[model samples]
Target: VRAEAIITRESGGGRAFHALVSSDGRRIEADLLVLSCGVRPRTRLASDAGLRTSRGILVDDRLRSWSDPRIRAIGDVAHVADPRRYAHEREVPGGPAGLVGAGWRQAEWLAGALIAGEDPSPFAEDSPGIVLLKSRHVDLVQGGEIVPDPFAPGSGEVASWADPRHGTYVAMSTTNGVLDGFVAVGMPRAAAELSLLFQRRGELPSDRSLLLRLDAAEQPVRATGRDETVCICNAVTAGGIEDAVSDGCDTVDAVGCATRAGTGCGGCRARIAEMIDEWQGQHV
Candidate 1:
């Protein structure tokens, strides 16, 4: 691995990239170049306004700025320093979650507290927020504290399976038979089931390897439950989509307009479409 090598320019041998010229005069040959420049939270406004800033505007569990309780922050800018269940006596930690769903949840809760005059409890995130890569060529889903050493003193039970030939991999960590963290690649069915189980904090079956069977060719795809969240970004459920379909929503867009299912992230659009077809078939 070239540590901290900065690419200055690209050289092409044919139609595509052939090599990268670095500042230190290193020519790194490559067939494909993927640029993955990450984002930084813009906290200048908060910092200039005198609110503490680190990675983002540091806020309490209530999302109120430590320096100014009247001033609140949310979305990509707010850094939650004091999370729920964390004692004040303990060191403050946490930062911007960088997830749209988390931001949506924060906004919804904050609106209720500010405008609706609701007694809002401490804002709690869906711990270890789910990440989905919405793409046709690749199916990847990850969530929770996945980096723990499985063999560590208290790392919990870890199970993994790989089929490199099929480009499928599954690895999960659980505590006391409960799913804690997982990463699934190239296995859509397993990813969906794992996501649901992670969200619900459900227990894994005794034979955890059963999850592998979800992607088998002979195994029929399981139907989602009515209560299962179809669009996590909007908290839209399968039943919600069914209701929309029953109300004459024929297309995915119509269902989205009716229930706001596929509007966020677009990862659940395929699922919404599937639900629409299933429900429409039932009606027919």
Candidate 2:
């Protein structure tokens, strides 16, 4: 429903109570609402800590605090600067992705940076954003750059398959034969398959029409390498799942129980299942 205006009050006013919209405009009604949310970047703590705070806590590409390298920031709390640049604006990274994947990537990088005592290479500034919506029988996944370089050498192609009734829209662009930008909606298998290609930055075949096919007749999006992550939440790798399958984890639930992979977020459950099938075929 496209809400043009929020009707907080009954047709006419004179109401003792009204529904409350959330930080992002979600309706919630109660006699006394205990609120704990903010749409704005919370910088009070950083300011109090004497850290330079702007739209967010300013941090270098390494995610180190501008004032103190010992302190690091990640996710929505920190504004990451472009690591490639070193100027007055060097400290100002572009807008934050504000996505879970962004934070997860930061956490993973931070873990490595702390151990190695070096900056996280290919940091979050340029990492693609993934949009996911999962439910019992519904699935949606979008990732990669939204706008591709139109004039770049060996420019990518844009393709899409949409179905409004099912609320499905899949649009993607590939540059120099690589799967780069894509938006997948209500296409679980296709989206899941395409995601791996996008993440891998893998090259597409000479005949790329199969990728845009909305039907099940479309070709598979290629297999996952053993080392690549199939489930980010549990840090489960494709090889790990293969080992589990070798020990007799046949179904998604079984694999989850064995490795605790899909128990969180459950975004990778489909991919996990796909890998299990691929593994079984190879073993057979």
Q: Pick out the ten consecutive residues of candidate 1 with the lowest summed lDDT.
A: 1-10
Write down the TM-score of every candidate.
0.80, 0.62
Q: Which TM-score value belongs to model 1?
A: 0.80
Candidate 1, residues 29-109: lDDT per residue as tens digits? 765676644458998888788877777887888888888888889988888876344433345466687777788889988
Clashes of 2: 6
Error of 2 at 4 (Å): 5.6
Clashing pairs in 1: none
Error of 1 at 279 (Å): 2.1
Give the clashing residue pairs of candidate 2, or none. Answer: 20-28, 22-26, 80-93, 81-93, 156-174, 156-175
* lDDT (Cα, 0-100) at 274 in candidate 1: 71
